[model samples]
Target: MTTTPAAPVATDDVRLSAREAAERHLRALVGRDDARLREDQWAAIEALAVDHRRALVVQRTGWGKSAVYFVATKLLREAGAGPTVIVSPLLALMRNQIAAAERAGIRAVTINSTNIDQWQPIHDQIHAGEVDVLLVSPERLNNPGFRDEVLPRLAATCGLLVVDEAHCISDWGHDFRPDYRRLRTLLAELPSGIPVLATTATANARVTDDVAEQLGVHADGTSDAAVLVQRGTLDRESLRLGVVQMKTPEQRLAWLADHLAEQPGSGIVYCLTVAATQEVAGYLRDRGLEVAAYSGQTEADERHALEQALVDGRVKALIATSALGMGFDASLGFVINLGAPASPVAYYQQVGRAGRGTDEATVVLLPQIEDRDIWAYFASLGFPREEQVRETLAALAESDRALSTATLETRVELGRNRLESMLKVLDVDGAVQRVQGGWVATGRPWSYDAERYARVAEAREREQQAMLGYLRTTECRMRYLREQLDDPEATDCGRCDNCGGLTISASVSEAAVAEAGQRLSRPGVVLEPRRMWPTALSNLGLDLKGKISAGAEPGRTVARLTDLGHGQALRALFREDTPDGPVPPGLAQAVMDVMKDWSPEWTSRPDVIVVVESATRPTLVRDLADGLSRVMQVPVVGTWAIRDASVPPRAGQSNSAQRVAAVRRRGGLDADVPAGATVLLVDDQVATGWTLTVAATAIRAAGASAVLPLALAAQG
Candidate 1:
């Protein structure tokens, strides 16, 4: 039978003082009789528990920021207050916090995206006053049901509110999040004298002031004088930092293969992209080292198991992207960056994961020349243009009912991810509302903050330059990073390479380098055929919907442009300044090899070759098609031409609906195809696959039995 848990009883030790009670809770939390709170930790706890005031604590990792809140929760509950609500940022962090609360004898529960089924039961427990502490994600703050139903009551009844990773709350911070801005509304709803705590290890002077200002404001938009700011020096005594520069990516991989095991205990190897994580992990595994790849693409269950594996020292390192940045706690003995982060602030956050539980942790960076390109790609995804925002608002204003993101895709020119992000910002800004089905206009006046966005963009550019400065600086590495974070006590650490403490070897075995090069050079990526047409295509005057009737066969690409192997070559060949000509001999050779490997998987041989007309690189596309036809002994059939030669093809079209419409309006097969013949459809590159799909469909209508698509590169 199901039963609700009973509410926690207050501590019976009334004779003990508040400090004594906090000490007792601390000892219980750390499972050590000798455990005691630091001075700043006690100050933070006192501000919340004794003074009933808002506080922001900025301390280094492993400085016991969590102990203050957990201890404060114990004291507050003992004084007959309600449960403490913690707005945490990451799932991994939530799990760790819940476990820590359990250690302190506090009954904690969580509600996040991964636990939808348990939200109601958890809410029941909260209503029953059985939960002493409740953890929630920042995204949950604006959830329609929770915001309308649960949040108001939780705000009124909650005794304490904690915002962990508070750096994300400020736009000036390296990891700015739009959802976190909703905390202002929550704060405005909070009753006076309800103690609140904000904590982060990575807030600079600017971010610190921003967060403190937010915390000090009350329900009536008035500032309180009693807000406490407890900030400590940012330093890690256990970290020994160094930089190892290599001439090429292959040398870096080779060096890792040669020296990864020589580092301290289990750790992480950070990569700039998901593709790099996979490639690095595979290479390291092939070299007889136990490793696994972790990214946003990794499954939740698999990610949990991988975390466990790392904590248990089963894997030497987790080759990962920024997805593993926050809230993952382990006694990591080392951290190696395969490429530099865009800013020193972000770099400091990632490296903070290490040296938290142990002394003498090794930190290294292998700076790459390609880091700037990766940074630029991410920078492009920032806030949209003023015109785009206006277009979105106009569309919502014209709609009678709430429109889903898919429906908006037909009317707006933004991609799905970018569009959803903009709507969230709009919702938080009071210009729109996210309801049961979708979003609706709130009719509230909203203006584009052009100057603010421009400032943000300029700040990002400065941060990028600062990261580049870190690479070339000859000063103390640790101190350099600390200064970038605006640490007042930034000083030289005696353990970095510049300080003459340690020197990393730049040597790699020639054989290992050769092997690494060969592994990266071997390339063939399978492209799955598009099975279904994009939704609401009919709205664009295209008579297409549901599953495509005659789609192109599953195809092959020589490599993804994101690949570490053939990517460099393909990027050079596709540059705007590079003159269009015959395909490079080296790339042509690689394409032939890809065909050789893919031939065994084919259901039938191709009898004719058809090339997709390219306005940008026509010479390269035609030369590739003719070379393939001559080598494979297939007849050159015809060209797939753009029906309108006067109109230039649009570049950087955002969504699939727009891309499909554009392709169908201009795509046509200009050559005759033999009936019941297999046709090879070739293109220079495949981004959305709409052009190839349209061309293949046209060929099928022209009496071809089957169409096999091929591309030189795939854009991920």
Candidate 2:
């Protein structure tokens, strides 16, 4: 059952001490009559309300960080200060805070991506003194309309400002969100004497120092060295840690199937990738366990439902990616990682989700060898090369009017997602700004800090090495993690598997192993065709723009070489140094299995096979095409040849606009085709799918009735 707050106190009572008022507020917030404020909590509240000074609190999870802010909001509101303005990082965090505030009779409202329709109402509430607290996602601060219309008023009158998860303000934090850096601009614009509070649970000394420095600087660029800092122990006695090293994906899956039922209560099973989350969730359900998959791809409404399910114990677990991390408030009984995150700090943050409100909870790491490769893939997606940054700045500078991200994508070589990430970072760095329609070049002097970025990259490498060391360490697991966070008083915890010996059995029944093996070895994934050409492609001098005609049906990839089952084999075949060779017997066989398991959505087989010409992997592409042709007994049509051999392969490019241009410039399918004949277009791999799209479009326009795109393996 949920907690209910105590009755509201009479705000007009002159005799209520700050301490008395704070205790009352806490009682109301937690629905406890005897709730007492911790000494540090009281100190933070006094600093914000009485002294009106900035403070930083680095406390562990379930540490009542919210109470400090919520109680302070109530006290400040009763004193006739404007509503507290909170800069939060996640929607789940905002939702939890809003609920907690309601219990305390605090009228809290939020404005974020999922509530655009309610933003005006929320603004009115704040303006009319109806809101005791206002919460907003950091990304909202960068929205052109929000920044121009709402921020100035709030900054000028907000009684208190709270930066939750303040560690994100530092690039060194476990998760570096570029949008959070924009908080500096917000801080600079805040009215003088407004109390500011920054709270985080995951920062090491280095990150804390950086965040403190950023928080100390005021609007006029004056630095105050007197900012208060509160540091606390990260040690959680309720957490029992363990590591189960598994040799293969199947072994891990089999182990989970056999052991998950023995876990204490409903909890979270964290996966490193969205695909893995979905895969694990599916396998678990097949094993008759109630579970759900949650990721960024899940709709906002669905994510909320899944979160509620976990909280209410409706499901055994929510198989999730980092999207479900950070702001989730359930007192989960366990947290199991299928693949270890690259950093020990990040690992600590995720595992911290467990044992928060319970006496003890399981925290296990099922580390797999594939995790390193996965980490390397993601780490490579960080800040673009200097040339890409310059190209983006130049494109925006040339535009007189603001250019939308789609239009900018046409002008730059970066993919839309990568391009957007770069622009947001640049926006915070003051090199550019997102304005009314899209983005504009700020024309501010900006230098590419190659040194800083390199340092960050190096830091990431060190973190990865530390995590690997964590797997092998026989010392206290909790101590190893605390030391990674640079905890000053790190010590051995008698709770982990290392300290007490393995409490979890690593054994799995052979039948379970066989089932897991079958599940992992499964191949084939549907490739949903691009519905619309990227926005503003015409501006880049490319005639191709707008919706992709529907005749080029969605295709199939034999496997996402990233899959837990067949991924290892596929990775070996696609390795950089591996010579271009003919399709191997094993991979060729996997393709046959994929054909057998083709989705019902793809109802037709090809009448003619078409190969996408490859300059670098010609032998591999042709051999795969020939192999497929022999298997399906389909006629081999002429290949799509490159118009110019001098154009570089589109292997390294990350953006869709450039990939399309490169593929189109090399124009394929020169000859006309028979009408009404189905064509199976093949490629060695599909990264961005532009190559497949361009080839398929050429085939369809050349009078083929239908086109089915096929590839040996799809890039993860």
Best by lDDT: 1
Q: After superposition, how far is residue 465 of candidate 1 from its true place, in Å?
A: 0.7
lDDT of 2 by residue, 139-186 (tens): 888988888889999999999999999988988887988889889998
TM-scores for every candidate against the unseen true structure: 0.96, 0.96
Which lDDT value does model 2 have at 206? 92
RMSD of each: 4.8, 5.0
lDDT of 1 by residue, 508-565 (tens): 9998899899988897888888888888887788888899888689899988877788
Steric overlap count per candidate: 0, 2
Q: Point out where model 1 deviates above 4 Å.
A: 1-16, 645-652
